[model samples]
Target: MTQAKADIGVYGLGTMGSALALNLAEQGFRVAVTNRETAWIGDFVKEAGPLATALIPAETLESFVSAIKTPRTILFMIPSGAPMDAMIEAVLPLLAEGDTIIDGGNADFNDTRRRFKELSGTGAHFVGMGVSGGAKGARHGPSMMVGGTQHSWDQLRPMAEAIAAKFEDDPCVAHLGPDGAGHFVKTVHNGIEYADMQMIAEVYGLLRDGAGWDAPRIGALFEGWQEGPLSSYLIEVSAAALLTVDPETGQPMVDVIVDQAGQKGTGRWTVIEALKMGESANTIEAAVGARGWSSEKSKREIAEPLLTAGTLEAAIPSETDLEAALIAARIIAHAQGFRLLGAASEEFDWSLDMVRISEIWRAGCIIRSALLDDLATAFRDEVPHGHVILSPNIAETLAQKLPSLRRVVVAGASLGTALPALSAALAWYDSTRRGRGTTNLIQAQRDFFGAHGFARTDQDGKFNAVWPDLASEGT
Candidate 1:
């Protein structure tokens, strides 16, 4: 074992861990790697091919620690929560002062904050880094959101930038804020992702059922969308997925797959945290609900024949209108996500920079789109009342596209097509625009039944109304 030899150490040889280690090695940084399954170490180093010289495989944790130089940096690419806690406990004894331990996983921000505090005064620093782009991105270039002490950022920034995805010439990596800010941002990122996917699926559903378009036609439509404002990795992948034929059954790949969508809990976590903060993430909530609804496959199968809501004969929307509707819904979803980020920043005192967040997300991340460039400008130049949608450029864009969204939502309602995410976005937008919403009636009802006490429009204090009992009068 070479003592104080490698630039950094990576513990865990999982898909992401291996890829990231390889990426670091390929970037000319000597990397020390180890895993619980020690047998995989030799294999991983060997598979590195010519890059093998840059990789130092350690069969044990002690040797792995010894391989890294003073003020060592170790990235743990294991599952978050209990597994991470176990790794921390195991590795803490082996580390010296000034060492940095980075949790590079989709951790719950609450857990990250807890761990961050726990590591304080212990000499070693703990960094909660949210890494996006999956395995391939890890191997090539991924967007990294780092949240820790400034000291840790100073130590990690050089290598991070070297291995990160680039937009123009800028790396898609940033020290967002302290403690758990990175993970929180990543959580909202996934929530917005859920909304984006659901909205796209809703559009596909409308085209399939209402317009009676075949898979190939829908695939072509999605392919064409890639040329415009909607050009994004998700749209490109969706087009590819739609166009793929299942060679086994000679059917569209989607046709052979089950409808039940799988979730790994990040979307649900986003909704939970948003509600806890008293913030609105309606589109994300709707997306989470849609996934839950999807899981009841048996119930849906049984109810399909038994339930019937009378469907009105609906006019199919034009492709241009559909494109406009998707763009508008996407804007609403991202705005809601950013709003939640703002609320969280206030609550946590992280002072998150929305412009930097937008800039870093423009490449490597799944939601990378041209739209984010506009959002970055909105955050940088003029976001009135802390609302991105209120920015002049975004507001003008929304004004033009919202009518198309409204038309699509109405048509979907008339067709009896489920459009939870899209409908939620439209509803949120409408509610935001309304200067006088019917919430006054809701306040009155709450005060009437629960004596919650409503504030009067004409007065400064909360007031309760004394009214006749309607039930007694009816009897």
Candidate 2:
């Protein structure tokens, strides 16, 4: 029996996978859909009425691979770690020369890099693509960060752009670089995502716990902010979640929900890379820490009995000031994340375009915002020399907004509400802006203890002081 060739074969049928397949089919691609569980194929095709016509359902791995034509494209929308690798191993024997395999998951860049090398000479194109915007974005359009050989990208680019969210005429997808570059960028995206969410949570706590504002009031603020520079998907979603009352309990839904945040490792990877690169991303690190702290419910419960809740009411800052603070915190966290990316680009020779990255982030992603539009403009065509916050426009913005950040931080501190992300943001901004830091003492201490030697500000060469010489002199 002869079978028709599919333009693309999607190798999974989970929520995201299904959405992606539907999206491709909607875009007029003859898509082949597959899953380890054969049941999903029936469910998918039955649910997709008109679109189902363009979709070819496959019951087995061999059938799935066979449905796609020569120089085929296979996209794996599965878990990031071992499962993704296992699928690749199983698919490799089925793939022919010049075939393309795209990983649309939150995979580690190191693994992506290694896999690219491992698949070399097999003549298969292995791409690491980072797909964002969740289920809705998948079905409609997502921000796709693709990385692989130029040949594979040439084949995938049209379809990729067609299925990606657009800002005016620009698609929210680009070939970031070679293998691992897409996932590397996505890894930092999640890190910044964590920081952004944490900052939002912190400010919400300020309104609810410190300012004595109810969920509805706090939600209103988010709704208002959505119209401004801070407008973003997370803020929009937060507004909805904050305002929702349980119809059953007639109470705020947030009040009954657990405080713990679950992480799937990408945020932690951002911090790890920042550390390895010797770059500062304390804001993101703090966000990951906040999630960790939230998860230790038993310890927090035990500590709560002995801890004193702040009794003194701190004077509430103006709503304008709080909004400014939120905006400032958001900007700082983004700067830190981009700075990390800039560092990684040098190490990996990705030649990543900050403006392009920002453009892609302007739509079809969790972090999509008006701010990203501004960033896309601010990050010029050439590689930026410093952090995004230091750019003329952003610097002026920070100069105006930073004072508000300080006031909000003071308010949060006085009221005894935790503002780790907010506080770390201010700290990162301050440290980066300062011409002189107190690190001289740190250098001196390092030299005194370990004789590591320290570079002098007054001179070009490294120098060591006659420490108390307590150990050497037997004092």
Candidate 3:
């Protein structure tokens, strides 16, 4: 057993796992590390350099478990679906009562829930933890969302908070409910991230295609935006990407790269869950759809010339209007995400803290922004209408910024630009403000075709409208 007693056991030496192991070691916590490829364990320890003193290398799963102290806390940083299940099956036998197993990946929340239930009678505890901020954040400080039993939280809290990102000296880590709450929140965070990136890309397209602005010019503008309400990690990176010059070709780095966008299913999961819950996340849905459309590179290339709409010389919107439009669309997208979280919280009895979620997201996550500070403030008390956007401060901000979104969407439509995410955000916002909606006609049509009942606003119960038979009338 090598006589190595450690505070935590880290299984897997993937990019994220290695970074996190190093992070734990740097924080003065002894971390026992192992990998499926046993040879890599030595290399990982070597790469860790001075931090190697704190990393205990174990060649086998048994050795890994043995190196950790009693009532062990083991973190498996592997792929989410089947691999995680397999790891759980493999490790459960080696653990004892009061031991904890953590799944630290972008997991499907349903699976997290199932795993939690699966371990109910077993003595070992299961935790589903969401770690954000990418590999760099893992090595330094990442925002962490933890979900598990109170016992598991108590076991993991000290190490988790020690390695987590900070907002004004406050660690960006929280024990958010139990079972699937952490993973679910992370999914929605990625969904909002998708919308945020798509909206930013749309504005970049507008500047590049419609206004004929150079990449550096657009990049400079985005950099300046970081000082305002739009300040966030995505904006910072987008600016950095745009401003970078290719050494070999002397062109902008972004210009040389392929235009196709890639996704890893988290955004799609968010949309699917929202739909299943009878909620609307149109902006996120649109962002997912854009990524799908981006994947059809060959089809897009073939249809480019054949599907041309007559081009118009559209007026370019001012930078002020463009910034305002981004802020407005961003607000609506995040609001929709929050509503979905609220719905899930109610549905599963998670009792998620919206204010804390927003607060943690202010630093380490990809969607971290100055806007999240405002969102945290907005959710500090009960929102007026069960929605963040309806809060007085948020409502006033949206009212001030909405016209710019309208103008930008109109301009994009006129210019034949594909602004799916921005357009969807505007559409959702417009629908939200209307006390009466067009869905009544949809209900009427459903009743006419399928005898589905429709509720009348003037009456108490559902009623089917009497209508002329379409077949008889046509005959």
Against the true structure, whose lDDT is highest?
3
lDDT of 2 by residue, 1-475 (tens): 7667899999888999999999999999999998988887898899999998999999989988999988999999888889978988999999999999999988999999989888989989899999999999999999988878898899899789999998897899999999899999999999999999999999999888877898988999899999988889999999999899999899889988999999999999999999999999999999999999999999999998899876566788898998899899999889888999899999999989888899999999999988887787788834347578767888788899999999999888888889999999998888887899999888888998999999987899988788785877878
Q: What are the lDDT figures for the candidates, one per model?
A: 0.93, 0.90, 0.94
lDDT tens readout by residue for model 3, 285-356 = 999999999999999999989997676767888999999999999999999999999999999999999999
Kindly state the number of residue pairs that clash in model 1. 0
The residue ranges of model 2 lying beyond 4 angstroms of the native Cα positions read: 1-3, 309-313, 381-384, 470-475
TM-score for each model: 0.98, 0.97, 0.98
> RMSD per prediction, one decimal?
1.2, 1.7, 1.2
Which 10 consecutive positions of candidate 3 have the poorest summed lDDT?
308-317
Is 1 or 2 the stronger prediction by TM-score? 1
